[model samples]
Target: MNWIDELTSTLGDSIHCDEACLLAHAGDKWFASHLPDAVLLASTTEQISEAMRIASKYNVPVTARGAGVGYVGGCVPSRGGLVISLAPMTRIIELNPADGIARVEAGCLTADIQDAAAELGWFYPPDPASRKESSIGGNIATNAGGPRCLKYGVTRNYVLGLTVVLADGRIVRCGGRTHKNKQGFDLVGLFCGSEGMLGIITEATLRIIPTPPARAAIQAFFPDFALAAKAVQDILQAGHLPAAMEITDAFTLEAARKHLGADAMPAGMQGHIIVEIDGQERAIKEELPSIMSILQSCGSINAMSATEPEDIERIWQLRREFSASLRATGLTKLNEDIVIPRSALVELVDFCSQLQQTHDIPIACFGHSGDGNIHSNIMIPLDAKGNERRAEAEALVHELFAWVLARGGSITGEHGIGIAKAPWFEGAIGSNAFELHQQIKSALDPLGILNPDKMGL
Candidate 1:
């Protein structure tokens, strides 16, 4: 029987073997034209297991997908494979405010959990920009990091456990709802950023924190990207740790201000920062002065800190929508997630700027500056009728990644190395690590039917 026939007979009409619809699942934002061979929507764990069994039997690549909101083509099935979509399984199984944990189905929206936590005076801090649409499954698969990760950490830090469907259809549970585990392998860590290679995660146990009572924001305008980078360095050196810290240089800041209007920006700013402080009123007062002092010392033209709730929200709104600002500019977009150590922030930004100058391309420099993860992504001119500009832009990006690696940084920070960065894996991690990756992949899915062409393994 054909792959679709087996799925349809086992899963009813919900399982489709249609090439047209399957092809629709091929490329995500990173490669809009890519397509897959088949698509499977599994409503139950058993169905997923069965799909895996069929995929393994046929030696067909199997890829699990979430809401397809990933920025780096993490969900895209580059090779013709069985794409198992988890969107149908979104269900909040339990929320224990007392335990400070939430048990949820993989497909649940990340923000929905946050809203549920907010109602209970708790917080799920690993909120990526696409929180409203991104599934918890995708977040787990990519080990998603967010602006608040500097304070709260990424999905890897919070994901205590998962219910995973193996490549051969066995359902296994890893980790627990507890604080510590001393078992053989750190399965949670291994699966957290597995990029759907190890197995398909069907459920997750999340760690939550108490909601901060008073949150504040501070925006600073700098003369250059280096100044903003230095200010981030200073903030980290200080004893206080803000809940959230972000940096956007003049180019991206103006882009936000331009398309988003005056209200989209701080009252006065070129380079900008949006920070959140969680503590007593006195603590907020104490940190602001130290933060401002450093900003001034770093060549900031002007600075503003919002103590009022309304002002703070307004400031954060600009940052939350910064990624979408590129769409308003009508430029072909490449949201490269490059991260260096905190000490390398200045060097990294300088390298990006120098690279842009040499290439004559424009980039929007912004990211969780405090964490030293910069989104120095460029926008190719959209007006070029031919693919000439696209090819040139693609080559320019490879050059940029080469520099990023030379500076001791990975090609991806929050976003996983989906199809987009798979080819560059050798450059980023070298062949030795790549072989280890292959070994892990082989151990998990012997027939090689999970996210086949993804993550380069």
Candidate 2:
């Protein structure tokens, strides 16, 4: 029987090979598209396991996809085979505050889990910018990190257990709901950032922490980017660990002003820093002054503080709107999430400015400044025909990656090395590490059917 007939007989209407379904599962937020031979809307782990078994039997590539909100083309089925979408399996099996864990289907939205935990006075701290739309499965696949990760850690920290479906349709459960687990092997960590090449995640048991009693935020504006970068180091050196510390350069600040109006930006601000803190109300109140004083000493032009939750949210709202604001400028935003040594933050921004001048293309620099993960976006201007200046942008990206690698930095911080960064994967990890990765991939996915052509594995 044909592959379509077999899938249909096994999954009924859950299997779709129509043009619309194929196109829908083709790509994600990235600028790459390829139609899959068929799309499997899996609603349960059994369906996924069966689909995988069938795909393996047919030697068809099977790419497991979540919400399709990934910035990298991680979910794009580059090979024309089967796309197994887990989005239909959105179920929160349990939220146990007593145990400080939430058992949920892989397709559960990251924001939904945070809201559920918050209702119980608990916190799920991985707040990726796409949390509202990104799925737990996708976050696990990429081991996503957000601003809060500087203090609370990334998605891998919260993942206590996982239910995974192997490429050959075997089911495996690793770890448990307990906070501490020293099992035979750390399979949970192994699969968290495997990029869906090893196995398909079906469900996850995530650790949650008690929510801090109070929260506050401070927004500081600097006359230049150097002072802002200095202020970041100063804040850390002052024995203060903010829940989240973010910075934005002048290019991004100007774009925010143009897109969000003059009022959206602080007056005479060339660089902006946001520092957030959470804990006891009195402690937060006491800490604000010290933070403010440090900012002032760093030559901050002006500083604003938000004590109330609503006020803090308003400040963060501006930070969250940055990516969208850049898009509003009618230029394609090629977001490159690179990481450098904390001491190199200023140098990185300076390098970005130089690249911007050299290429004559707008580059917006912003992101988790406290941790050295900056989203240095190359804003490519389109011609009258509405096509990107691809050649210039590509050349700039190569240079940027080369510079980052030379300085002991990573090509990607949060976004995984999808097809977009595959060319540099081997070089970035070195030959020994790259070969180890290949061996692991071959061992887990012998047929090489899972997420083919991704990460160059």
Candidate 3:
């Protein structure tokens, strides 16, 4: 029997090889696209296990996917095979405030969980920008982070347990609902950022904390990025740890000005910072001024504070527009989420500036400055015929990653080493570490059916 016939007979109605399903699961936000041989609209862990068993038996490659909202082409089925989609499995099994735990299916939306937790006076603080559209399974797969990660940490930190289906169709449960456990190897963590290679995540037990009563935010612009970065150090050194802090450079600000209108960005402002703090009403009310004072001392321009929720969100709305503004400039934006030591924020921007000047390419830098995961965008202008300089842009990306490595930084901070970064994965991790990775991959996925050809494995 053909592979499609076998999958259909074993998996029943859950298997689909229709053009619509194949096209839907083709790729993610990245520019790459490839049609899978079949798409499995998985609705249960049992279904996924059986599907995997069939794939393993047939030696068919498998790629686990969720939401299809990843920035990297993590879900793209590079090799035509079965694409197991978890989107149909959406379910919040349980939310227990007494236990401080949320049990959810893999396909649950990140923002939905956040809203449910907020209603219960609890918080799920991963807050990836794509939370509204990204799935919990994808977040766990990538170990995603966001603006609030500086204080609350990433998706991996909140993941207390997981239900994973191995390549041979064996279902294994790791960790538990408890906030802390050291029973054995951190197997739960092993899969948290595994990028769907080791196994497929079907459900999760996540830790949740009580929500803070009040929060306030401050928006400040500086004469230069150096002063803005310095203010971040000063705020942390002053014993005030804000929940979220973001910084932007001049090029991004210029794009915003041109796109959002010149009045959107103040004149002579080369840097922008947004700092937010959450706690009891009185404490946050008092903390805002202290942060503002530091901003002013750092030579801030048009410093503004927002204590109301709507007002704070308004500031964030504009902050979120940085990416849109860059896109509006009609340049091809290649966003690289790189990380360096917190102290190197200014230096990283300076390096990007040098690259811009040397190659005549515009690079925009902005993001979670408190931690060092800045979204450095290399904007490539289209030629007269409206074709992007993709080759030149890729070479520039190579140079940028090397520079990041030289500075003791990572090529990717939140997005996993998906197909987009596969070329640099082995080199970035070095030979010894790369071998270890291969050993782990071999041990768990002997057939190499799960996420084949990814991360250069």
| Candidate 3 local lDDT, 56-94, one digit each (tens) | 988999999999988789999999899999999889999
| C-alpha lDDT of residue 118 in model 2 | 95
TM-score of each: 0.93, 0.98, 0.99
Q: What is the lDDT of candidate 3?
A: 0.93
Residues 1-457, candidate 2, lDDT per residue (tens digit)?
9777899999999999999989999999999989999999999999999998899999999898999988889988998899999898889999999999999999999999999999999999998999999999999999999999989999999999999999999999999999999989899999998999999999999999999999999998899888999999988998989999999988888888888888776756778999999988999989999999999999997688999889999999989788778988888889999999888988888898898899898889999998899999999997678888988998999999999999999999899998989999999989999999999999999999999999998
Give stretches of model 1 more than 4 Å off. Answer: 18-20, 32-34, 260-270, 382-388
Model 3: residues >4 Å from true position, as ranges? Answer: none
How does model 1 fare in lDDT?
Answer: 0.81
Taking the tens digit of each residue's C-alpha lDDT, what string does model 1 give over 1-457? 9876777787787776576777667766675445666687768788899888888877887778998878767777767667889988988898987877899999999999999989988889997888999899999999998888888889999988789999989999998887677777998889998988899999999988788777678887776666777777777787768878888877787777777888654544546776677777787888888888887898876578889989988778767677777778888778888887777876666676776787777877788887878887787774456443676677778887887788787889988887778889876898899899999889988887787777777
For candidate 2, the TM-score is: 0.98
**Ranking according to TM-score, highest score first:** 3, 2, 1
Best by TM-score: 3
Q: TM-score for model 3?
A: 0.99
Clashes of 3: 0
Instruction: State model 2's lDDT.
Output: 0.92
